[model samples]
Target: MRTYRYKVQTSSYGLFLGITAEAIQLNAPPTSRNQVSDRVWLDTGRVHHAYSGRKLALNGQEVTWLHLGLREYTESIELGAPGSYVLIIIHALEVVDADYAEAALAPALAKWTEAEFGLAPRSGRINRDSTTGELTFSWDERPQ
Candidate 1:
């Protein structure tokens, strides 16, 4: 299984959701349009503040894929700055076979969103060691 990761700050909450939805659309499995739902489940906890309750799941593929398919996790890091400015790492994982999965959503999201710390939101593709399952990530230099 491959993991797609993005880095963002508290201020980019809306940007995060936008890019995520766009990424899912970019990588949606091939199927009749009517089979997929347009609705995304978001909770109030992740909507305004606290960062503890915020989670977004795009289970729109249940009809087509027969499963939730895509799952996301957001890690919040407090910087102790005024206004509680914090960094967030968002990760998306596809549970289905790659052939019918939205594996490209992260990369597409990275392309559509702004960069941070001079690095794309999707800093790199995460590789899991087949034996140990240890993950590794790296970002390639693209022409600016």
Candidate 2:
């Protein structure tokens, strides 16, 4: 198996999460209004979270506002696990194309890593998928 890593660029602070999963499974954001989108405010104290669209999901289940795919890939990517790891499971409805992905997903990942995870952000590369224009968000993080 091959491993790929990318840096994340975030507007938030501190944390960086690298998505090095086996593959990225980008899917369309869910429709129904049963859940809500989260609007967050990171600060000196506890961060504030607001929701109004779809709740975040890790693999295929609902998560708090943390919203990460690779984290849910297993229970522990904590310090010493095996395989690559994915970082986020974001809303991609507005991501009409790759350029949109650049603007939307890229920054989202960075900011998520910074504020939510509290890690410095950087760029990351995905293991190429078989199809083109296919949307997916999943990864593997093997210790090196």
Candidate 3:
């Protein structure tokens, strides 16, 4: 269970997440359409400003892989019986209460239990650990 922490700040319109080359796995299965972005879900809040959201593709960013938006996020993934792979954890934004930092969308997360490069959202909220930051959606590996 790896944890990728993303920081969200309020933009002039809505909110934006800063993604870098290290934010996602650079080396994953190649796609015919590398430009296509895969979707991941944000359980904390609903997003009201997707139109303003664009890939903040920064210069000199090591984007060997890019993630497109999907309808959701997944919990576990089966990358070919434990073949070496990186889970492309993307940091995107959706609309939610500003006070809460985490939402456990376990149902959505479970979709990836054995998926090969699948995108799904956490189905529900599991825990809210605000020890570090108070405005973040995060997850760890499923307990053994």
Candidate 4:
């Protein structure tokens, strides 16, 4: 198993997203619309901040963010028989309670992972560290 880890830190908090796979592949096609299209779910915590619209585009292998007031969002494209991907988004806030944010986002993240990539958690765990103010999520590939 290979583990891929990525971390992004802001002044207020940090975000971590990872994925483990038997093999990882990247496909960079010439056409703009080479990516697999899927709907992403967002949990804005507050009703007012809910994601109103989604516009997904592929710049090489990266998926752009949906309009949800997020400072930054990203994803990786995996190429294979059961191709899949992972996404990470961070909000720019002056002061955020990491614990609360993690608790609120975990289930939403899980649901998004399953829906977007068609993969379920095979091992490991997802969590957010209050002290470090980092939200962490991970998933493994399904068995053949």
Number of the predicted model whose lDDT against the real structure is largest: 4
The TM-scores, one per candidate, come to 0.23, 0.25, 0.26, 0.25
Relative to the true structure, how large is the alpha-carbon lDDT of every model? 0.29, 0.29, 0.28, 0.31
In model 3, which regions exceed 4 Å deviation?
A: 1-51, 54-82, 98-100, 103-144
4-76 per-residue lDDT for model 2 (tens digits): 2233344421222232112222233223222222212111111111122333233222222223322332233
For residues 1-144, write the lDDT of model 4, one tens digit per residue.
Answer: 233333445566554533222222323221322132332222222112113323322222122221211111223223222343322232221112342333223333343344344454334244556798454544444357
TM match of model 1 to true structure = 0.23
User: lDDT by residue for model 3 over 1-144, one digit each (tens)?
Assistant: 222223323422122222211123434543422332232211211122223564423222122211212222222333222443333433342323342222222222233322334333333223333465322233444334
Q: How well does model 4 score by local distance difference test?
A: 0.31
Worst 10 residues of 4 by lDDT: 65-74
Residue-wise C-alpha lDDT for candidate 1, range 1-144, written one tens digit per residue: 122333333331211222222212222323323221232222111211113334445444322221112111111111112223222223333232322223234443343333321232434453445677343333555436
Q: Model 2 has how many clashing residue pairs?
A: 37
lDDT of 3 at 77: 33
Model 3 clashing-pair count: 28
* CA error at residue 141 for candidate 2, angstroms: 1.5
Off by over 4 Å in 2: 1-66, 69-98, 101-107, 115-117, 120-124, 127-131, 142-144
